[model samples]
Target: MDMKTTSLPLSDQLLEAIEERIVTGAYPPGTRLDEVDLAKVFEVSRTPIREALIRLETMRIIEKVPRKGWVVTPISPQSLCEMFEFISELEALCGLFAARRATPFQIQQLLSAHEACRDVDDPDAYYRANEGFHKALYAAAGNSYLLEQLTEMQRRARPYRRLQLRAPERIKASFAEHEAIVAAVLARDEGAAAERLREHVMLQGDRFNRLLQSLEGFGRAGR
Candidate 1:
């Protein structure tokens, strides 16, 4: 399968644009994003704009106003921390299970996805390919219920994760982390896979610090 598609679905393209703007501080929390304005900006009709807004609403990245328009959702630091903690543990559990249960075919899929990610330089292209990598890992866990939960948690954290990848040299760092994760899983080292996956999912040191600084700036702008 061609793992990297340069184009996203129309609504998804709009969603990514708006999401990038919000996470990067171009559209701070509580700033209004009107359908008409967005439609004009994206050169699309209101239909796709509405669809994108609805998806963002589900992700809790934006909210519908009472007859006004949509606004970016404000995220409290505590809430952001809690969400990341939840995703970290959830994905770590997946990695642990995957180490024990992933079939040879699944491992190959994981490696392929990683290769796709490595071949892409555009952040958006890499972002899409990166989803394939994680999805492969999630499927390899061999637990449908767990996968469902992790998928929802991942959806909720999507915007922040995209922002995380935008940090300087973060794409390389993330790929390196994935390499460690892949090696651990290939070795059937459950403990190592779990630890590496947790570290990969959970922001720390410079990355977490940078994210906190951005959140603080967004918070101040919203206030």
Candidate 2:
């Protein structure tokens, strides 16, 4: 909650960089992580890489595996589903409160963030924009505690969520959902906004299964 208040130390910088690669699927779940290689990649020493991995392990984003050393934590279907369920409800709450409490300027921020998500060609670009829109929504809720909790949940779900957009046409579908969410919020229709936001973010049935497979195949060949 207190993050980004100051310039990051070297270990923290490497921590975020490694976290980015893990969430972006550059270092997929189940892939073994070598501190030496990571040090080389970041042009730092093993000391910082070790510190970063220790932090990631504490967060359970990566773990020490027997015989394998450090590896990205495997995504369990149940755990992923549980996280999404919580996130969906939390986001729904954000929409509900934003509809009721957001200022005109906050609404304008939402509009701008939503527009940023428009017309993005690449999945990563769209993902970044999508993240911005969600952050704007979270802030618009006008509750500091809710913002903190939701942002933490979003952090934990980042890896799975990022990969979900890679499916063909998925980004398009997501954008359509966003439109409905924004429309409901702008109208100050709290119920509609909540429902739209919940439906947009839920991971279940076919979508859940496919993502589980992808997350498990999950790793590079032979990983």
Candidate 3:
């Protein structure tokens, strides 16, 4: 049987599952991923596996070798730092533009997104609301091209963001920051919005670095 011919959205499903595994450290940094084994384990065809791996490679989550299949990319502390610096600038700009350009309706929508996060008890739901809040802010900026670029950057940073949510305190702090940003937008305070957004993004990077260091220390102790 050609297992790849299944009616399911196998490629997408496989990609999401693998991505989750990677983010949760099931397949830690630098781990080797075996396509045939994953295919067997997932009870799917090799075709979907190949497609998923290719997508991951494009996302820089993994690297393909001529004869060695795929190798997972490590999330180094330095890389995380650099990514946060870039993200901070993007978000700060988005907030600044949003403050000046957002209509009353758009400001309301952003506020609603922040409120939604308060009712989200699960980490996944909280993350979804958190994303909605940011995307709403970007939309409020009224610059389609800039929003597109920022969205792509967020996609590339998804794994690290997911890691950051492992700490509930961090999630609460993020929501608080979102509230501050929304308040600034409502008041049309561009400087406050931009400064708060920058601090929010930079704080994530700082906390993530500390978290990574602690995880490494725990690993060493275990060894």
Candidate 4:
């Protein structure tokens, strides 16, 4: 796979910012997204905001009604479960392939990114570094199509995953999971890497229940 990239355009930048807000519950379910107000907030014209809204609609993060304009899509518990289930499988594939195929250079890069995560005290910094660690795994998988699909799913799930970071002791646990995954990859143990990755990616068992409770609390607070 080619390792080329481009910076996000103004519209995409706005889309990510707005999406983050939506995921973080700043603009909870049913919140109206006014294009003109967004344009003013971002100091950009309506064209970019319009484009961003269109992309959000495509992601099912928002929807337009006949006369109600665009509103944040409500996330049901079932939908959240389904999203994480898909993400878990996708990332498991990435880890499996990466363990079987990663080059020495790629392994070193993954370690570096993991180390960066360990060094960050701020949640945002850790989040960015965590992203780098996962992207390295995707790149190491050596499949362009899988990388593209996984990237999109990851982007869509970013907010929920970010919320997980706020859970008690989650950062430390996440880093430990990353360590295990990195070790599995370096050892060329495909099954171990895949299983570890799945567990790490999925909000299952206790984690899933906790997140559901938190979301419920957030919904009540918003009302």
Candidate 5:
């Protein structure tokens, strides 16, 4: 029995289970994902399997094909770098605008979102709160177009960002980084805010190495 089959909603449970298989290498890149087979393996209805696969598809971790219903996407280090580079530029602009235009209420909401992360030990829970904080920044920026772009990019980066949180003390470090970003925004330092936001998305030095190590470890952990 899957240990994750409890309390969480049916769709969430299914998504978590399926994504775990992919990350753990049980469903490696190019591995076909059959709905009926998955339904039987998890002892669930096809409805939930379809729902879970659709969500994974949005993450760009899996895709549908002509004959193969779905297969894991081949992710590469270069591709990850390219995605982050684009995301960093988007985030930097949002942070810069937020620092300049955020109202008192929006700033308060941003702080609330960051507070939501404190004491959160679970990687998934932390990731959700972390995502909220980013969304709060976008909302503060008040740019509908940029918000739309970042929203999709954020979705693509979700799984990797969550996995990155699994690194030792990474969650704590992430929180502190968030604090610095918030501080810069509150100070209304546009350049500082942009730089910090860019740095957050584009991990450097030890942080980048940690993400790489985490990815390697994830592959090794797969069945």
Candidate 6:
């Protein structure tokens, strides 16, 4: 993808700022996002901020309050599970079709994308490279509808997915999984590629659940 930094529209900029903050945990879940404060921070009027908050609300990222402004939505374990389950199916289908229809060029692109993530250590870098790998895989599937749904699911899952790369070990494991999937796709093994992708996505959900359980335990211990 191009690295162009095109200027965002006022409302889009506001939305992006809030989304970045939330994804980075700067504004943790359940924190009330004050429209006036955000407007001042972004140096814009409340009109754009209001519009941005409405958009976020539509994404289920924020909840509109009775008297207060929008508050960050709390992601429950159940909701996380459901989201991941849906994504697993979508991505598995993508991988299946990609194996069936991927051209040599597309397979090479997927391999190159996986190679890019081989030794990435920085969390953000690893995350971006991993995302590229998935997107390439989705495109290789050659199903426009599948690609669109996968992209939407990815956007909705971004915040939680960002948390998955907190450890270098997780990043390494993810890259390894990507490599295996690429190998299967290149070999035109549709069933194997789909199985690998399903396992990979499900493993991510498992890791997230384990992290949540650990956090709950730590909270109970007042840590």
Q: Write down the RMSD of all candidates, one decimal each.
A: 3.6, 5.3, 4.9, 5.2, 2.0, 4.7
Give per-residue CA lDDT, model 2, range 1-223, as digits (tens).
Answer: 1224525688877876787677656787788999999888877889989998998887679989888899988766788899999999999999999999899999999999999999996775687799999999998999999998887888777757878888778899999999999999989999999999999899978888878776656454324
lDDT on C-alpha atoms for all candidate structures: 0.86, 0.85, 0.79, 0.84, 0.88, 0.79
TM-score, model 5 to reference:
0.92
Clashes of each: 0, 1, 0, 0, 1, 0
Where's the lowest-lDDT run of ten residues in candidate 2? 1-10
Ranking by TM-score: 5, 1, 4, 3, 2, 6
Candidate of highest lDDT: 5
Instruction: Quote each prediction's TM-score.
Output: 0.89, 0.80, 0.82, 0.84, 0.92, 0.77
Using alpha carbons, what is the TM-score of model 3? 0.82
Give the residue spans of candidate 2 off by over 4 A.
Answer: 1-32, 41-59, 63-71, 220-222
Q: Candidate 3, 221: how far from true, in Å? A: 11
Off by over 4 Å in 6: 1-29, 39-55, 65-67, 203-206, 213-223
lDDT (Cα, tens digit) per residue for candidate 1, span 27-78: 8877999889888887889999999899999888888889767888888877
Local accuracy of candidate 3 as per-residue lDDT tens digits, 1-223: 1236534477866876787777666677677899899999888888989999998897789888778779878877778778878888889999999999998889889878888889565565576678898989998999988898888778778666766676647788888888899888888899999999999887454586666765465445533
lDDT of 4 by residue, 1-223 (tens): 0112325577767877787677656788889999999888878899989998998887778999879899999988888989999989989999999999999999989988889899565555577789999999998999999998888888677767777777888889999999999999999999999999999998888899888877767656656
What range of 10 consecutive residues in model 5 has the weakest lDDT sum?
1-10
Off by over 4 Å in 4: 1-17, 40-48
Candidates 3 and 5 compared by TM-score, better number: 5
TM-score winner between candidates 4 and 6: 4
As for model 5, its CA RMSD to the true structure in angstroms is 2.0
